[model samples]
Target chain A: MEKAIRKFWPIFVLPTLGAFAIGFLWPFVWGVYLSFCRFTTVQNVSFVGLQNYANIWIDNTFTHAFFFTAAFTVVSVALINVFAFALALLLTRKLRGTNLFRTVFFMPNLIGGIVLGYIWKTLLDGVLALLDRPLLALDATAGFWGLIILMCWQQIGYMMVIYIAGLQNVPIDLIEAARVDGATDFQTLVRIKIPMVMSNITICLFLTLTNSFKLFDQNLSLTNGLPGKDSQMLALNIYDTFYARSGPQWKGIGQAKAVIFFIVVAAIALIQLRATRSKEVQQ
Target chain B: MKAKKVVSLLTASVLALSMLAGCSAQPAADSADGAAESAPAAQEESVAQESEVAQEEAPAADGAAGQVYYLNFKPEQDEDWQNVAALYTEQTGVPVTVVTAASGQYETQLMSEMAKSEAPTLFQVNGPVGLANWRDYCYDLSGTELYSHLTNESFCLKDGEEVPAIAYVIETYGIIYNKALLEKAGYTADDITSFDTLKAVADDIQARKDELGVKGAFTSAGMDASSDWRFKTHLANLPIYYEYKEDGIGSTEAIKGTYLDNYKQIYDLYITDSTCDPSELATKTANDATAEFVNGEAVFYQNGTWEYANIEALGDENLGMLPIYIGAEGEENQGLCTGSENYWCVNKNASEEDIQATLDFLTWMITSDEGRAAMSQEMGFVTPFDTFTDEFAASNPLLQDADAYIAAGKTPVDWCFSTMPSENWKNMVGSALTAYAAGTGSWDDVVTAFVDNWATEYQLSAAAAG
Candidate 1:
């Protein structure tokens, strides 16, 4: 059986493995290489290492976007997970309208990022218009908070759906046992139910963190790194660098920025996973 | 797992096969039947698309398939252009196709379109780098019938031996303000000549914004995504373009931003005293800004002349235009910020019959009275044609301002902002300046960014292009 598995392993894996190499692995390797080269299109490229990397550090907007994206990810992850977990707990009860509430809450995630941005931009601008200015008024503080509000509103529902699934599978026998041991309902939840759903929390945290880091369309359509570059996220920063200049060479710098972005995102994901994994109670 | 993998593999193969088959199986005009039906005709068509000197020397279009295509850059200009196309198609009986690139994605569309064998016969290769990129695709038109009518030879793309494109039309922009709002605030259009006078007027209008039933003299200075170019490119050039006005600045040139501090004076006024708070402007988009301006709630709308159709179509004729004087010393007779963001270029790779059709279409569009009039009405500005007239131009007070600026011996500070690889550079500048607009970054940082980073971007772009 082991011999059969070994022989068929490559047979089973080859297509997907080939696809991965072509679609992701090859491109990822090329991206790292391109970060060192300068060219308009990939067909014609000239190697010029260090310059793209050096320019990225000198770019103040890139620094600001990095910090901004980091802060946004941290705040958004915690809020989304906590709020979603709470919603999941509430909705997974023996109560009426639970399904309706879940469906309604998750609807925002169904809308696309660009659409969400435009809708929120209009809504926020309308609200602020009453205060004598619209959204993006004065500067990007409103834009920053507006984006925060948008991210939360758009994400919470999606996370809640995941959390609800986790809640449903939380081994009801354990909670019952805790209750029989003279534990209060709240105590039972804290000790038993919470520990059982650690995996969900980890998943929710990771998704929110990564999404927050890679945010571009919403950022682009909402603030567009507006009030100049104050609200620019990392993705938009890379996009702006690649297309907004005149000479035929910015692709290298843009590629380098993208590579750095990948590294930062991966590192943050690892750290988040580690942190979340430490708290995970193995079922 | 093995069965599932096999099933997925089958599905993936089917999909890949279908996609490749779809691309390759096109029964296009350049199919195998090409050599059989009309070898002599194909040769004749190629001559029409070649240079006119070559056209003069080549065979006639007796057996040629006369076809034309204009890959239009402006979706807004389609209504007028389509009618013009129909008229020309009727006039010449050559099959003409007019395709409009989806708004803001012209470059992507053009590249893919150019790769096809039956590529656009005529399309807008808009600027210097664009022309440079599309060098092979365009047939040289140094001495075409269309080139003969061009009085302003400056807009032409000149190589050592040839000029690739001749300007089809010209448009101008500065600032579009609410004239009634200004009048109600106790000021007139004539009162806005110099920077001092303009500032005085804006200050007064802003002070009594509520009295004028507006939020402020200028709309929300939204430095946001949907509309960063209004500032990053157009208004940002006020200083640089103003400095370059002493010596005529070309479309492909980037001048050092020497008068940047002077440029900041207007930008400072725009952000500081506006109705919207600075922090909020970062998130704000141009749609919000335009909505306010269109609703007649904002006195000043920062936009180009092309916006007149949208503004007027929305039933807001009260909207007027002004130049970006920005309280500069001795700036009374300043013209409206004027230049072409979209310049039309016909494809050179097309067949001779196609080139002739495009040239015929262009000639008729400019020379024909009805065609020129419709274009003017749609555009709401002066066409480069010396004798063209339209109601939209006559009715629009903004055009009057543009005319005054031009007639006063004041050269229109042609917006040189398109000199950059606009989308990429605009975003960078927009991002860098957002901090300043948000009151977080200092002016020095912004200036340093524009000066030093512009050079870096230039070098980066040069290396990439090379």
Candidate 2:
């Protein structure tokens, strides 16, 4: 049976390989190539060397977006993981109505990012009107906090589900032994349960990190980098550069920015995965 | 084991075949449509020509008239364009496809569509700046009958000796006032000829809102994306226009902003005497402003003739337009902002047959009865074609008011907004305007965005163009 499977592996592998090459790999490579060229369409291109990269910093909005997105990612990742873990810990206890609570918490994850942004915008604006304060678009600080709240609301449930599964898989006998040995609840959680769930923590951290970094639809539908593009994020800034600004050169600059974006995300995600995986327990 | 192996092999082959089928289906369908059209197109070629006026230019080579694919820009006129396209296709047996881009997505849509094998044969350029991006794609109309029929020489966009594009519609925009509401406020359109009088009337009505039973003198100067264009672009045009007239130039790399103080006064009037709180205007939409005017809640709504359909609920006798007076020199003699951004350009990359077919279709649209009716009545467009006689002129009251201004010898303000460096420049100015209106920022920010940013954006665009 093993011999037969090994011999037929090519047939199974080729389909997925062909699709990956066509759908992702080919376009990605071609996109990288196009970053160095000035073109209106894919067919019409002329190579212009490092000129596109040099043009990226001519407008300070790109750098502003980078710092803004970085700050948002840091805050959102910490809040989402901490709250999600707490919810998972509480729900994993022998409590009543756990299933109902889980379903209710998870419901927001099903709504699309754009729809969620708009819903929150209207709700927040209504409250702001009642308070007679500046609306979300007029206040950059409010816009930032609004986005954080939205990110937490949408992401906490998804991360909580993952943490719940990890908690459930922790060896029940080990926890029992800790309790029998007069170990306190906090001690057991820090020493045993947290180490046991290190793998899940790694996954949740990676997901939140990348998602917060790459958020576009929510940022766009919410503030749209309003208040003079002060609240703009990296993804929205790159999009504005590509589509909002005319001229062939802007397209090339946008592509170069995208390439830089890919590198930054890849490096951060790789570092996170490596650091978290090293701490994961063998069990 | 043999049976299982046979099933696995069969499934793999099926998967590969399905992928191939998916890849090949689109072009196959596209070709089938072409094949179907070409057959009838050959037989009805002469018949199509015979129905129209005699052509002075020679017939298309080999009499192979091609199909037309027009990428329409205006979403409101989508239905009218579809009806016109259908009428032409039914009469001429030439397949005409009309694809209207959603509002604010035309440039992005045009980029992707132009990359396809079957590109749009007829498309539009907003003005000179827009033409710069797609200049290589525009076919010269210098020798066509369409060019000869143009009523105004200035309506054609020239590329040296070649006419790359022709303006199809001449629109007029100003302050559209509800005559009934104005009279109810104890004022008439004639009572507000210049900015000073306009301010007085607006302030009086605002002070007497309780007795007059109106919300405010003007509808909200909405700062939302849907309504910001009224101030950021249209109102901003006044300053640019006055500056241009003073400098004796059409467009400039760096605007001096000589009339920004006037720009501020008019903007201040709109926001202070308006229906809603200035801070809340950030959330107000175009629909809100239109509803205020339509429901008789406000006496003035700043918009254009294209809004005739939206505001027609107000009786025609109650509708009137006044020039957006910004207190420049000779302000009382200033007419409505009159010019067009809707210029039609044929795609140079399309087949020669398709180009000729597009030209013929455009000619028929301005000359034929059904076509003219659709353009004038259904679309409410004031075409720049000589064939559109007074009988086919638009019956829109706002348009008639614009004509009245022109007849009174008011010098019309050219649409200098077309020379705006980029959409990004507009957005920056819009943000500054919103910030100032909301009191989160100062008026100095607006001036900096208007004056300093204009030169920077122009320089950036010029550099990119090279």
> How do the residues B240-348 of candidate 1 rate in per-residue lDDT, one tens digit apiece?
6656665565533344776887778888777765767766676667788878877877777778766776677444456667778765555765677766655667776
Where does the lowest 10-residue lDDT sum fall in candidate 1 chain B? Answer: B27-36
Clashing pairs in 2: none
Those runs of model 2 whose alpha carbons end farther than 4 Å from true positions after fitting are: A1-15, B1-14, B23-65
TM-score of chain A of each: 0.93, 0.98
Chain B alone, TM-score, model 2: 0.90
In candidate 1, how many Å is residue A201 off?
4.9
lDDT for predicted candidate 1 compared with the true structure? 0.70
Model 1, position A172, has a per-residue lDDT of: 73
Among these predictions, the greatest lDDT belongs to: 2
For candidate 2, give the lDDT: 0.87
> For model 1, how big is the CA root-mean-square deviation?
8.8
